[model samples]
Target: MLDQTILSILKEQDQQLFDLVLREETRQHEQIRLIPSENYASPAVKAALATSFTNKYGEGYPGRRYYQGQVNTDALELMVIERAKALFGYPHANVQALSGAPANLGVYTAFLKPFEGKIMAMRLDHGGHLTHGSPVSVTGQWFEILSYGCNENDVLDYEEIRRQALEFKPDVLVCGYTAYPRLIDFEKFGEIAREVGAISLADVSHIAGLIAGGAHPSPWPHMDVVTFTTHKTLRGPRAAIILAKDADMMDRIDKAVFPGLQGGPHFNTIAAIGVALGEAASPAFKDYSHQVVANAKKLGEELKVRGHHVVSGGTENHLLLLDVRKSHKLPGKRVAVALEEVGIVLNFNTVPNASDRQKPLFPDGIRLGTPSITTRGMKETDMVRLASLIDRTINNLKTGKISEGESAWKDDDEAVTIAAAVRELATSFPTFAW
Candidate 1:
């Protein structure tokens, strides 16, 4: 809970702003959050982020600072670093980079010279992120990027990937994805990278918590570098961390993150990361991770039973991608918007083989996860209900049977009565804090 003094000060300074923030928080607790990339941090984590540590200007690692008066911040920093290394089994950890993209860039800056090496990563259209060498990113401008794509079975093609690695012979082999619905074989990726003499970097940003919770395999022992955001499934503040297999790489990672990339680090977020890391190490976190996967599988099963097509057939982790167009001939974007109007939240994604010819968006898929909804204490039954609501919404939209739009409801007295009933049904499953 926020202190009364601070709340009073905020009210005096900007009551409207404070009220707006409060409403947003309330909204999150009232609606299901199915986005895999989002989560609600614990009150402890939020408090740490809103603490006085935010005023500090910590420019370097603990016990070695560029600025003064960091004794407490140094302790917080060391706690965060040690907790991360212990959790992930890394020789060294850099908790300075503010987010995942910069943490990845820090790894590249430390290991490879600018414009001198090649980067082989999963194709962005397939599931890879832009920082892995999309043309629009600085990564692509600096290094030659070789991209690999999924095979016809909608799975990673290791043989083709090895062939490409031998053909391009990149200095770095990146293994990770933002929308992949299956488990990653990190050891195989390590083997392939070793065969090509390329450094293996695993961006476990999306699955960090799952890895920590034993819901997924760890890439620490098999990969040379790993990067992740502390938020998302980790349920922490918005922050980044980099783990290296070599202790000698620590200095390089630190330098690249500081003078080579960003300015003063966010000590407050680092403190929150420390708190979150400590929390994640508990037995409860393991249970949470297990539930995350179980809930995802349950949701996938429910969606499939409702006549929807789940990408990769189903999910093995926290997320599931639904090919909405294939199931109902409705665009994912349209379905997503309709669901949002009914108090559900998720994102539209691109599924394999979905083209603009079939749907205006090349890949018409709805990507959802059980992380936040699970945190809200929702189980298989809620997922079934959610999926049924989605199917109904899609069916209604496809048949042009939605008789009441928001504008129509707001203007017409009778339509407003119908809209109120719709909202009542939507509000029956109100979300609550974890």
Candidate 2:
């Protein structure tokens, strides 16, 4: 929660903006917030972001910075780097990246020659991220991309992946994903990369906190370089960190992030990340991580009981993909909008085997996760209730009780009923000061 005094000051400075912020705060407090990539930052992390360090322009690494008055900034940056390395058990870490995408780009910049390098990555429709060589991204336009996808059963086929890697002979073999609900075999990826003479990069952007808390397996021994956003499951400010297994790769990554990519680092965000890393190292966060996965599993089970088609049957991680088109007989886009009306906010996503007719914007599945709700202290019991709420809302949509409109379905009686229930649940597990 923001300080009331600060709110007062902001209200005086710009009343309209302050009112909007208040509205957004109310919305956050009211909604279920099932988005996997979202989480409520702790008060300590939020305080760190509001520090005077944001005013600094530390343009280089700690010891050899390019700007004056970098002594404090250097110390802060070094603290963040050390904390990240210690937390993730990496030999080296760069905490200067603006976000996950740039951190990944830094890896490409560090090792690959422009317009010549080849990358083999998971297909986007199969749970991979855009930076993993989606044609719209710079990584795709600049490099030759060979994409692999999950098998018909919606799980990674390691043998097929290895075969593709060998045939493609890519410069880099990327693993990790955005919406994958199964445990990744980082060792298999490493073996395949080794056999094909490729660098193995694990973009654990979505699972860094789970890895830190031992809820998920670490990509340490097998991954050459790992990149992740600090904000997602890590519950920090919007920043990123890149970790490398060895000194040589670390040197190249640092050079790529600094002189080759971004200018000055966001020191305030780095400080917040350091705080988050400290929190993640605590036993309580480990318990929280475990609970996050448990809640997801329960949610998936309950959804399955409601006859929803959960991708891969259930989830090993914090996220689950629901085949809305199959389960509810409604497009994902429609269900997502309907859920939003009922205060259960999530996103439309493409399923592993989505037909060509199902466009990106109107995908066949909905992606949900327990991160934010878990952060709010919701657990397995709450998940069962949530699943019921979702089932009822979709049923209402299907029965034409909640009519769709150009705007959100706010005026519908059933949506209002579900929204009330959602508000009650959310208020019971308040995010304030957490």
Candidate 3:
């Protein structure tokens, strides 16, 4: 029988850890969580993670395994694969890659040789992920990598990308991004990759749920390989799935994931991913996906009207990048820390064209998204309120209403008032409503 509770046994067994978790939960419930890469796993998905499947060691695919007793594990994984294929329209699914980075490594191991093969991908500070060939990541160190980025206005011009691809003639051409606010044109990427004899690999880990929910265009029938993490907008557990256009390509990827990269699969996370996939396919999740984008658009617009520097002018998807350098002498880290003290939480990030302005550690912008708040049932109007809270906080520092220094926000009375209002608004919505 499937049975569970709200960490009741953990509370009785280890009161210390349980207390810590509850405190974090309270923080989550009371803060405006705007980080783009973050979201709350659904109750059902978390429940799946807590199931008895964690004890198994399924070291291989459904039919073939080094360890026995995979009868139930095999069924669970196969069911998840079918659900993924149905959701994303991919012909092959590898749900055992642990997370996005390994899944990407699986793709590379299948095609490119170590310290060889030219790879072209987007630049990290310009919205691309580290796995897409950042200099610090193994992907960059192991391969010959060239980078592309958004233009001065934070827009990707496909013609420029095509020109670069023609010049570089990479073995793999990568697209998809982390902080990009506009729609990804996968078809254009495919066209350029084919023209240059490069394989089109999209790490759609950020927008996979949006694509599945019809909030964004699908990469299928265009991309040869796609990698996705199940958390974020999918509201799933922390795991990844890779897809191939056909089974022939999947053979290389499968061998790479099992023999080349990982050992036994985390069946607990796999089970949770299955539950999340089920939730993502529902009508309610579809509505949630669109609302997330809608909320982001509204928030970006509201902030823009208040004279904040909204990068790219506004957003077309679930995220917005705000350049504080346009309005403040301090870097974005200061504003981000101040907001955290006031109960709103997000990350400081490099804006488009950051090299011309700030370094990576102290970038000029803050990156925020609507996935977390939208999960709490926040709408466009709520975004209006959120923007006001943000603007007021920024302006408080701008106009000398509050001082800026290390933890100075904790001592300021004006900051106290802002925190009170933020807490009220954040706690007004149920922690996990939608």
What is the full ranking by lDDT, best candidate first?
A: 2, 3, 1
What does candidate 3's lDDT look like per residue over 203-229, in tens digits? 888888798889999998999999988
Q: 1-434 in candidate 1: lDDT tens per residue?
A: 34456667778899898898778866776666788989878778877888999998978777788899988998888888999999988879988888988998998888889889799998776778889998889998898899898887778988899999999998999998888889999998999999999989999889999999899999968998899988888888888899988877778888899889999889899989999899889898898888999999988998888888888889988999888877877677777776676667888887776656443353578889888877667767777766766665665554223455433122244333433544554356444344
RMSD of each: 3.5, 2.1, 2.4
lDDT of 1 at 226: 90
Which residue pairs clash within candidate 2?
none
Worst 10 residues of 1 by lDDT: 406-415
What Cα-based lDDT does every candidate model obtain?
0.81, 0.90, 0.89
Decide which is better by TM-score, 1 or 2: 2
> What are the runs in model 2 whose C-alpha is more than 4 Å off?
399-411, 432-434
Clashes of each: 0, 0, 0
Per-model TM-score, in order, reads 0.91, 0.96, 0.96
Q: Model 1, which residues run further than 4 Å from truth?
A: 1-9, 356-362, 399-434
Candidate 1 CA-lDDT value: 0.81
Number of the top-ranking candidate, with lDDT as the measure: 2
